[model samples]
Target chain A: AQSVTQLDSQVPVFEEAPVELRCNYSSSVSVYLFWYVQYPNQGLQLLLKYLSGSTLVKGINGFEAEFNKSQTSFHLRKPSVHISDTAEYFCAVSRLDSSYKLIFGSGTRLLVRP
Target chain B: EPEVTQTPSHQVTQMGQEVILRCVPISNHLYFYWYRQILGQKVEFLVSFYNNEISEKSEIFDDQFSVERPDGSNFTLKIRSTKLEDSAMYFCGGRQSSYEQYFGPGTRLTVT
Candidate 1:
């Protein structure tokens, strides 16, 4: 089984400021990591993922995440945020050798204020 | 680019009523899934489907819940008797070989 923890329930940042949303996971086996963003009343959009190779993964919308094996963490970061970036961010994980069902974190609400 | 689509953007039903939410996954995708999120809550996986049958399901997929690929283009989730707790935004997704899943806009079910 895989479990994810997103520490902050809400993050308020001024527009153009850098932001980081913390995420941690616990899994006995190897796993795939992902971050998704959901706008109000909309579906989740893939932000980034850590499947293999480089631990640092870049995604759409100028977002990125680093998969730290020792820390069991995958934190999402952006140098500058836009007001449109306000959304609910979810961190998810799936066991590599087991079922592909994704276990998601409680989510972090990003409020990019102008 | 192709993407997943869901119908009946919003549904209102009385308690104990049966409701079916529909979805059309991306073409060429083999895996389908259903997930739900109540207001202000995290998304929870309900079930996953492959090869015309269920591949995996969460504990929340109780006897009241079922999934089907009635046709090549349509995937549906049926709730036999909706409870107040069943009210949530139900999302349908599909994966084409990769681990990444594409999601639909979702159906907001309101059980009154």
Candidate 2:
């Protein structure tokens, strides 16, 4: 079994400011990590993922996440933000063996102010 | 770029009524899945399908839910009876071989 925790429920940031959304997970087996963004009334869009070989993974829209095994964390970061970046972000994980179903976090709402 | 498409973007049905949500996944993809997000809740996995049969399902996917690949291009999720609690945004997803799954715009089902 696996579970994800997104520490922040809402974040208010000004444009061009750096932002980070924290995520942590617990799993019995090796896992794959992903970040997905959801605009209002839409499905999730893959921002980036960490499968293997890299601790720092870059995703779409100038976003990135660093996977920390010791801490069980994958926190998303963006150096600059645009008004268009305002959306709900989700952190998800799948078991390395099954790799079929995804367990998701509660999500962090990013409100980018112009 | 190829992407998944779903029909009847918004559906409204009465309690105990049946509803079928339709999806057309990426042509070459072999794995399909259904997920739902209730208002402020986290996205929850309902079921996963491969080779015309269900590979896995979560506790949320109950006996009232069924999935079928009726044809080469169409994959459908049928709810035998919908409850008011079933109102949520339902997303259809597809994947070829990579673990990364692509999602469609989603269908909003409102059960009254």
DockQ measured for candidate 2? 0.79
| Span of ten consecutive residues with least summed lDDT in model 2 chain B | B51-60
Sequence-dependent TM-score of model 2: 0.98
Candidate 2 residue pairs that clash = none
Instruction: Supply candidate 1's per-residue lDDT for B6.
Output: 96
TM-score of each: 0.98, 0.98
* Candidate 1 residue-wise lDDT at B9: 95
Docking level for model 1: high
Writing each residue's lDDT as its tens digit, candidate 2 over B1-112 gives 9989998899999999999999999999999999999988999999999988999998989999999998889999999999999999999999989999999999999999
Candidate 1 residue lDDT tens string, A30-103 = 99999999998689998998999999999999999999999999999999999999999999997877557788
All candidates: interface RMSD: 0.9, 1.1
Which of the CAPRI classes, incorrect, acceptable, medium or high, describes model 2? medium
lDDT digits (tens) for residues B1-112 of candidate 1: 9988999999999999999999999989999999999998889999999999999899999999999998899999999999999999999989988998889999999999
User: For each model, chain A TM-score?
Assistant: 0.98, 0.97
Q: CA lDDT of B21 in candidate 2?
A: 98
